[model samples]
Target: MAENSLEKDYLEEDTQHGRYLTFSLEEEVFGIEIKYVTEIIGMQSITKVPEVPPHIKGIINLRGKIIPVIDVRLQFGKEPVDYNDRTCIIVIDIDAVSVGLIVDNVEEVLNIDDEAISPPPSNKTGFENRFMKGIGKAGGKVQLLLDCERLLKSDEMEIVEELFEEK
Candidate 1:
């Protein structure tokens, strides 16, 4: 089935992972595999769209391309904070679709090997850690690895596509 092939490809991609682009959401640090990252852009003006999810802050026009912007903090059910100079949009490619994840600030990209990562705790239920790929350890610090595939559901992606089509 097509799903099987997609899963296989994702697994292979996981094997090729090494570097992670680290960023912050509040005081906690998080990292996403560098392979999926396209570019890092500073905070930009967003066109607000109605009836979208709370986390979907709206869409941005990035050099003529319209892409939905997700507030990582709000997506995690955290309190909304004012966007400041340090706020950034981490443009990432997932399944050939580009989505911008608005993060607090970006830290340096680090080479976090597979051995330095561990699975998230399984005892919990609900959305907490739902998008976590792993917990990474480096230099006495921890970074929650984000699974981009899990971060945005297909239905939500559909909503985004519809918005663009209407524009």
Candidate 2:
């Protein structure tokens, strides 16, 4: 019985450790769970799909698979900037749908404890608040933890579907 209790405690602690793939957008550091990440690719030529939202940069051919790209900065309502050498597209798979998110650069993977994550601020003053799941305190600063699933919700998918149907 004591051994079973110890095992349970270990499992609980293991679950508390959240791994995030950190990245930079503008000057702020942001993170998303590693589980959702597919791959990080350098900036590629995107074939513009017309009439989609401005944030939807377009689609890219990934080894014969066409994946839609969303400019992360633009989606967060930031001013548009030219893609430079440091630009990258982080492919993510959520709910069986694959999409690419354009970021300024890819940072690093970090393991954050549940205790270090705090709920988002009540006042959604900035771009960080709308998509952020929480503020993860690490490495002497807060890493904006993004709720990727929430950020790329079904509404976006429906828009894409409708666009394709029209085309």
Number of the top candidate by lDDT?
A: 1
For each candidate in the order shown, give its overall lDDT on alpha carbons. Answer: 0.89, 0.86
Compose the digit string of candidate 2's lDDT tens values, residues 1-167.
99999999998767625989999989999999888899999999999998888998888989987788999999888889999999999999867667899999999989888899999987756544667789998878889999988876577877654544534
Give me the candidate number with maximum TM-score. 1
For model 1, state the Cα shift of residue 23 in Å.
0.3
User: Which stretches of model 2 miss by more than 4 angstroms?
Assistant: 1-17, 123-128, 161-167
Clash-forming residue pairs, model 2: none
Instruction: State the local distance difference test value for candidate 1.
Output: 0.89
What is the Cα-based lDDT of residue 83 in candidate 1? 94
